[model samples]
Target: MAVQPVWHFNRSALAAIALSTLQSGLAQAITLMAPRQMGKSEFLQYDLLPHAEEHGWRVRYFGCATVSPRALTRRLQEALSDFAAGEKWLMRQFARLAGQHAATARAAFPERLVQELAQLRNEKKPSLLVIDDVDRVLQLAGGDTLLREILRAFAGTNGQARLVLSSTLTGHHQGLPALLQQQTTVLTLPDIGDAFVHHLVGQYHQLTRTKREDDNPFGKLSPYQGITWGQVDEGIMQDAFNRLQRIPYYFRALVEDLVLNPERAPAEALQVQLARLQRHRVAVLSWEEMSRLDRLLLTEVAKGTRQFYGDTLRQYLAAQTGAARVSTSQVQSSLKKLMRNRVLGQEADGRYLIIDPHLAAALSVTDKA
Candidate 1:
């Protein structure tokens, strides 16, 4: 089959809501919070940004995920300086030179940023500045300083520069609310709803309708070898969505797998996807950071062990750690660290569970029946 066009779920409604919130004068800043790979950045770039631009707002986007603390100001200056020149050709040339000067861009960053913001403020059109992955900078050494500088610059714009920030989760830094220093509104990027799944079902049919019999991916011995793309339908796609925990990234992966091997059952394809996630760099790094006791606790939780202090688990912990005896105190200490690290999360009923879905699945492989 030929390569399929990238499918997109237009979040124009949500964009309208966010922009309306900003224009209502209730909040000068809005923060979008959602888990990673939940389309936070897509909404900002594809939906929200274009919607604001269409309404005659001047916009700039700065992503913090790839930049260090030192590069923060320089990067923002580049984004701000995009609007510095009067002519389109002049703007393009300035942007090119800005890219070339990134390494030595520090010395003149502040002054340039001030000039850019002043220019933006002087413009009659409203400004929208999106800072993606804003929470990450808070974890860096000089992040607080950078945030304060940003706050000072935009806050001084007298509401001319409307700010929209995106992060995996909110309140990464305790001073975040004060740092923005405005009536900041927090919004969650909603899940890719059922409509998108239906759209994918249609897209899959379009992409696979012309597949030749000789190009089938299934082996003669495979149970689904005789199954065809025509057998995949909206119900199958919806089931696949739920099976993948309603995450868009994984759902897209499933569709891609189907485009190559249309006969694969959603569950079987999902297992392959989950297995890949088990070996993902993030999952590997997280696993490497765990202590033996931490690893043991993780496995126990994955197995639905709620009673952390129970005698049976204490014995298991003692056996695993080669300790004379294990106490409730030790278990509690490790659990606290795991929770703080976000390796584990507590539900409303006080049950501790793994936060990352794939990590949970990988560790659960050793669970007893």
Candidate 2:
């Protein structure tokens, strides 16, 4: 199989390795969390799923953000039914039964899936189910209950079926039932580091030195046209590492900008592109996605009111909203949510700081408005 080209391997590869190693352990579920645009989805699609399939594990991927619970359940049942039947004749037989007893299929799909999974185990086969954007699933009505039941059905598979849940580090995960949470091993993707940056720059340089052909892996661009590897000095690479903050998305953008503006030096081109990206990220990327209360709390932190007790925030909120009073519990709850989302970091002294400085600048603008 032809594998897709990936930019550079990061810590997410380590997380995938850990998941593979722990397959025989007590933990049956792994929860992976990363910030937006951090390549979590691509890592699972191009790397993890292929690895699992190579080891003879049947893989079912659920894009949780795009499907409802009913639709998800139906799709899962169809896939498992296909797996259980194997032959075309057997699949036709299962399809006939599904059409004849639609109501029964609705009620018994979970049980049937469990049975089929057991059959796979008997045949010395195992399965893996990956649900991406699991946080979106938890936000739906009765989603927690539905997820709990689905996981419960898989419990009897005795390690035949492994579950991997991927999502941004949103507060919605707090809604997961205790049983599910306890069984899950949480893996967080750290921010891009210097090593990956160095590796990526090296990869680009190698691609440039290779003969430019129609089948050039790095794309059709002539090496002579733009800021080739030769033009990017050590100082320029270090400047990119610092200015792009080593984030993959930002790094890619900077590289593209340099390619487009080859006349400019790498460091100068990167500075221009980085400023543009930072502005877009602060105004359009991060701030627009935050909740109202989260935005407010972050704005307060950006304004130098770092330490916020429950009562302190409640009073501040009351004054800002023109409400007669606000509850301390509400303030505390928002703080916890913001912390989970990684928008705010709490120190040992209980003071909170806006985790991203660019976001702080955006919040300050909003505060003044």
Say which candidate scores most in lDDT.
Answer: 1
Per-residue lDDT of 134-184 in model 1, one digit per residue for the tens?
A: 877766677667666665666566667788988664212222345443435
Q: TM-scores of the models, in the given order?
A: 0.72, 0.66
What C-alpha lDDT do the candidate models reach, one value each? Answer: 0.71, 0.64
Candidate 2 structure, TM-score to reference: 0.66
Reference-based lDDT, residue 191, model 1? 74
lDDT of 2 by residue, 200-278 (tens): 6776565545534433666666545543447875566777766554557677666655544555677777777677656
Q: What ranges in model 1 sit over 4 Å off?
A: 1-5, 67-73, 83-115, 170-183, 210-227, 279-292, 295-324, 327-369
Q: Where is the poorest 10-residue window by lDDT in model 2?
A: 170-179
175: Cα error in model 2, Å: 8.6
